[model samples]
Target: LKMGEFSNGLFGCFNNCTLCLITYIAPFGIYFVAKTREKIREQKGIDGGFGSDCLVHLFCPLCALVQDAQEIQPAAQAESMARE
Candidate 1:
């Protein structure tokens, strides 16, 4: 969990098949993808702007979605574990 590094590679979507499948099948999943990117930006202090986010999603939708999911998953898991 490095500050600015992605825990999962862009093509490593199968590592979390559920997320991959959801992003692939969900029609409203674009909203989810945008939120995920925002979370990554905040959590990692990323400087990439809205335009870049849009371009990434427009050009590489699935990969971007999967990567965003992979980036946020670890932090979410850790928070859930801490709650217990």
Candidate 2:
């Protein structure tokens, strides 16, 4: 659970100015949401439908944003752990 705290939404938003700025701006938020959805759906093995994706970002942007940022690319993460 604690494995991804560093890159999680709040951490990213606080430490990375660009992530914070894009979170609140509509045009930019769209990009963030799309990227996040891709990352989660493709990298994290999640089944993310467009409607659910939009709902998450549109309704609870903070948590949604945090969740999106909360991991390494799945392959790299798995590989690193295997090496350890």
TM-score for all models, in order of appearance: 0.54, 0.44
Could you tell me which residue pairs clash in candidate 1?
A: none
Best by TM-score, which number? 1
* Lowest summed lDDT window (length 10), candidate 2: 1-10
- The per-prediction tally of clashing pairs is 0, 1
Can you write out model 1's per-residue Cα lDDT over 1-84, one digit (the tens) per residue? 647968888899999889888767553555556666876898899888755776677679989988888888898999999999
Best by lDDT: 1
lDDT of 2 by residue, 1-84 (tens): 446454465455677777567666545656567666876687667886766777777778888777776654565688999999
Q: Which residue segments of model 1 deviate by more than 4 Å?
A: 1-32
For model 2, what is the alpha-carbon lDDT of residue 46?
80
How many collisions between residues are there in candidate 2?
1
Query: CA lDDT of 4 in candidate 1?
Result: 92
